[model samples]
Target: MITDSENMKQTNANIAEYTVSEISGALKRTVEDRFGYVRVRAELSGVKRVSSGHCYFALKDESSVLDGVMWRGNVSRLSFVPEDGLEVVCSGKLTTYAARSKYQMVVDAMEPAGAGALMALLEERKQKLASEGLFDPSRKVPIPFLPRKIGVVTSPTGAVIRDILHRLSDRFPSNVMVWPVLVQGEGAAEQVSQAIAGFNAMENGRPDLLIVARGGGSIEDLWSFNEEVVVRAVAASQIPLISAVGHETDTTLIDYAADLRAPTPTAAAEKAVPVKVDLEFSLTDLGRRLSVQKTKMLEDRKQAIVALARALPKPKDILGMNSQKLDDLSERLPMALLNSTRQKSILLGRLSGSLSSGKLQQAARFNRERLLSASSRLRPISARLLTEKKDRILVAARMLASLSYQNVLNRGFAMVKNDSGNIVKTHEGLKIGDKGEIVFASGSVAFETSSGMNEATANMPKRTSEKPRPKKPNKVNSKVDTNQGSLF
Candidate 1:
């Protein structure tokens, strides 16, 4: 806020100023109002042309000079070219150039300094175009014998159109395409050139020939037809063009560039088509002449045939041509077949040799040897695997043998059992007259337990009233309990 206030104060110290365009526009308005449409005569200087079709130059006298610019629209209307040293008259409003900050005259009208200037310019342009071969007669297109459609470049509202239509209607009466364009004044050359180009650009029933026509006029009225743009456009046209711009006395540059030149619009139409009655008569005559020529041609052909027959070979020789050809083919047939069969037989022999039994046997032997070699490599591994498995089996068998209870029996010991074949580890399970089995090393024996092995057979101990004490197992004692399954 403070900086803005400071700027405001600084701006207030100086008075308000106008932009460059604002001042220039004010000056322009003042000058145009004061010196409107003034005419000046001065020598042209520093004349330069730009691609935009505008020419910029200086209007100068001995003491001072003023800049001037003539746009394409105004430049095209001039009767003569503006040169650097040539004095000329110009008429337009004065205006200030904003960009350059200077004043200049926009020239809308220009003319030569003397009466001969126009002719000189016209001649100069003609020479230039001619030097570039624009007027070469060899480059001219031949007018078509019969054009299905004709295009005309002219004012649509003028009597020129009516006259052309009437003339063509009187003749062959073809389809006509009319291109409307301005023929004089500002932008006339542009419109005329564009109209010609438009006709050239059309397709699908495009014109066979074009006619650039206008009513009779003075050189200034017909000046558009002579512009470089219009002439070039006519020269570059794809369709054949006919120049009928003015009366017979008036000529234009387009007349030299067009394919055909006609003195008037009606004459151009007559040249573009033929009279219907005359064509019919000529066609009838042509038909009669053609029939006569055809008959004469047939007669001449008959005489030619007779003469050719006289020069031909004899009939016998002519009839034998095919037979001679057949004889030649017959002579070649057997050798050709024989050669083909020989080649096939050679191929068959070579194939048979390749498929012989010896070769098959060799292949089989090679496979068998490969199998043997593979088996030979695997033999040691298979044997080692078998040997190791057998050794494990033997070791397991030894372990199993050592774990067997029959080994104890093989030590000359027996396992005593009761009558149910239960092992009796103690003799208490057995009593006198009780039968039992004794397991030996290889067999078992059934035996009756008569008494203890070391005790009397008939002696027995009676029940006592006192508690008995445990005694040594080696001797039979009165307190021995014989109901136990252990033998100590």
Candidate 2:
């Protein structure tokens, strides 16, 4: 036998040496070459998307797990959002990451494994959106009875749009605006959602109603309508929406969110508008009925008026009866008046016979005696009233004499008056050469104010006698002439 060290040296010499990177590269090449393109059926787990726009997840079953990565380009092409616990088939080539020294799948394409898986995913999504009230019946709006303009979202090149146009033409020609969009496959959901938003954002020529439709296909072909963005857009649309996405047996998330659902594209067109001919016929019929009813009502009123006129009494007969009664009263009126006058005359004659001249004289004498007696009694009262009146007059005369300004003149005072007959209370009103009157209690004398007559001389008392004797003129200038006669 060889020694242990010698054996190890010989084995090392035969084997090639490699660094960590070299071994990793060799493993990567081997994996890529062995399974160049593989299809994997597994359940998704730990699905995550980083800010780099790459999706990283793990594909696992009962036995083992495989790491998976999809670049941004591939991720954008997916029809639905990948979530954990979804069963999917991934198609890609096997590769090894040099840095981690591990094998993984670089997924280029992915889809739900079968119809069962798709149905399960759809049910799960429906439950989630329903819980958020996106599918609430109360949130849905009523479709317009007659839309003036209709907006359609579908593939422009497909039979769905052609069928809608043809059906709408047959029923009622409307303003139909077709928003062409991909209705299936990659990016179809985004296009469909954007078409809905675009219609809503229009300021002019905005449609009164919207119809999202697609031809019947497998679940995968119709999966775009089930996208959350498309479903939410349909639910939040202000314009009433009709979902005609698939056949009668096929349903989508959009069906629950839309205001109405049609079995097919043709059915949606029928619901959008009513037949023009039918509307015209209805209006004509209603107008005819109204006219007939109006005529009947007028006839009934005319008949009622005629019946009322027939039941009334004739005007000539009513007037004739009143005229006869008036004539009877006129014939009896004169006779009645003559009898009354005769009775009054008899009564007057009897009254005159009873009142004889002697009796009348007696009554007059008696009345005369009564008057003389009353006069005798009233003499003292009349004398007393006269005497009292004379006393009041005398007393009033005395009080008047006392309160008179003449009394002031009689008390050795004189009143001076201007030429205008106004009293001059102050000497300041007197000017030299101004003519005025000096009034005494007995008489008034005219005087002229001279420059030499001071206020002291003006204040002097004047002659108040009934007849004043003439005095010699003063040598000094005097305001008054001593020879002036009394004016009273």
Candidate 3:
């Protein structure tokens, strides 16, 4: 509301109701109240960034523009990615950047104009790619330990390229082929995949190793690396592959499908090549050991040959051994013959002694038979003669006794009898009897009379201390005590 009523200097006092500071303060308050940490829809423009990591940008379209700042903390949340030509809607607080003396909005979030719908589309694409078996582990290639040639798939101008090159050169100086491709914008995945396929098709023995790498960025900025097409290409690679993308914490399907994964481009290069200096040192050590072993073996063989030459025998020595054997046989021959003759003589003597023993045995057998015959004859003759002699002697003795009995009786011609009429055969059986009978060699007689008592009984000798009186002293007269076979 400008009026040309007074000169610019004269109208100043009339318009002194509001100061520039007060208006600015009022506007600041109004903007804060209206748009405090809110979400707004606008196109991106005038995007400028300061060294402090604070982004200054304009949210504009054909109709209007709003100034904005994204501090470091909030700047990380952007999705559609703020660029000069890109259109996005921001979510932030409308406030003043006091240090710059500027009115702006501090953006906390941003996205493409229709990100809500685009998310659905992206999810569908993800599913479609996933169903095609592009993420299968079976298709992944193996990474070679020592690669002579390496193929890099990344932006040609990014820090990733420099980092990987430096690492490869440090690890092993060798030829590396760069397969540069767009790593970020639309169709970035297709271009990257094509580049991989192209490098493979070139085949040139297919480069020993393939490195897919990129510098660190937000997930959206690095989405091309996570695409299914890129993953499938990596898996299908004939050569071994290494994936290096973003920070150590960032992961993608390409990382899973590749033969190896590294946290950074430099690490990926380091994994692909072996250190040259270390390998050379190892080779030198092995060669020295091999040479030493060969020399020792040659020395051992030479010593063996010398010992064999020293041990070899001469022809004259062999002839001397044969001559010694011949003389030994000659000295033993006469003693062997003498031993044979003595053995034969001993055998003949043993045969003669055996014949003499047989004749002596025959003579001993004849003598034994004669002795048995003599014993048989003496046994029968002696038994018969003894029986005849005993019988004759008994008969002669009986006749003689008959003739001598009368002679004896006549010499004693008297008989004695006792009181009981029994004969007094001997003086030992004599007793006084009333009757007596006497027999001589030719006659017998009986008498009754008294017999005399023995004088010893009359004396009583000590019988019971009394005289055993004879019974009236029966006196019987008897002939002399002479009997046929009795003697008094």
Candidate 4:
């Protein structure tokens, strides 16, 4: 009975043994149910945000250490980061990581351990970020006079966004993109920073400017804008940013880093754009001034042109001066001609008194007969010289005909040329496929050059197959043969 009892106990213990996953799941459910909303006040350590945007850290005191995680979705609800050594109170469900066989707290909310601690932390961060030049006035971007689109980073359901939209509509209506983010809580700073960066990194149709705004709140309620992440994001933004957190008295770190700061969300909208009515009035005034100035300039130009026209000489006056000079010249022209004719008559009379008319006639007859006899003798001499020159020209013509290329072509010989028009003196430069022309005694033949002397002989059967002979005059007519009809 003792052995059976021990075996039964051992079997019962074995029956209660659980698998790794089962035990993990059971522990997770028990711990979660027991402390579903427990708040842990401890110093944070080993805080790290992963690439996936999930935050993993440890909450520890002197006696205990608890591993904690804030999911990417729930992280946006946090207003401050849990840095190492930072005193914080975190609230969440206790859960287990089944694969690692470990348990951790899934933190959904957090706050600084006390108001004093949060203020001290905020001051320390402000100094650190300032030391890095994040708060330099030189780093601030200039707000555009007119932006096509404006981006708003705020809570979607709050009065802040509605007020900003209404103000923008009243002032200058613009395309407003609302990047909804938690205005306060544990990880709200990260969301705001991410929203800022996302708008900056946009490639297609990004907002021209950004506004980080929120409604009236206490220092704790506005702590998200004071975060290092939020401050750095504002400083590093490519587009100009405006900070409008709470009322005029609620100043945040973002207000310092932004290009412009507003007392309220509505003021931020006003600062972002101009009042439509005021702009219309200014435009109307400018247009009227421009029209008046243009009219004055045109009138001044017209008066100056009239002054210049009056100073210029008249066309009729110029014509009258030219016509009076023409008349004076015409009156002097006849007297000048008469004076010249009288001087010539006096010279003719003096010459007439010096000559004998009968002697001049007799000398003229004698010279005419003598000139007739000499001309008759010179005519026959010129005809005889002409006959001799004709004979000499005939002899030179025959000599030139014998030396010409046409006479050579009349023989059995020929001129061969390549496609480039160079005389083919030898077979040295000939390629097998080279085109060439062969001018024969009768006509010309075009053919491709041969690869070798043997190929040339085989290609031109009648040229090389016949017995070779000394070239003699052929019966074919050439261009030099006038009586012979053209044969070549």
TM-score of 4: 0.52
lDDT of 3: 0.70
Question: Which 10-residue window in model 3 sums to the lowest lDDT?
Answer: 479-488
Give the top-scoring candidate (TM-score). Answer: 2
Candidate 4 achieves a global lDDT of 0.79
Q: Best-fitting candidate, measured by lDDT?
A: 2
TM-score, prediction 2: 0.61
All candidates: CA RMSD (Å): 47.6, 34.1, 45.1, 32.2
What is each predicted model's overall lDDT from 0 to 1?
Answer: 0.79, 0.84, 0.70, 0.79
Q: Is candidate 1 or candidate 2 better by lDDT?
A: 2
TM-score for each of the candidates: 0.49, 0.61, 0.40, 0.52
lDDT of 2 by residue, 378-468 (tens): 5676567556655655665565555567877888899988889998987678777777778887777777766555554555457586665
Candidates arranged by TM-score, highest first: 2, 4, 1, 3
Give candidate 4 regions above 4 Å deviation: 1-45, 48-78, 88-110, 301-334, 337-488
Query: lDDT (0-100) at residue 249 of candidate 3?
Result: 83
- Which candidate, 2 or 3, would have the higher TM-score against the true structure? 2
Q: Could you give me the TM-score of model 1 versus the true structure?
A: 0.49
lDDT of predicted model 2: 0.84
For residues 301-366, write the lDDT of model 1, one tens digit per residue. 999998996676644454345445545655665576568557655655565567768775665566
Q: After superposition, how far is residue 474 of candidate 1 from its true place, in Å?
A: 99
Error of 3 at 326 (Å): 15
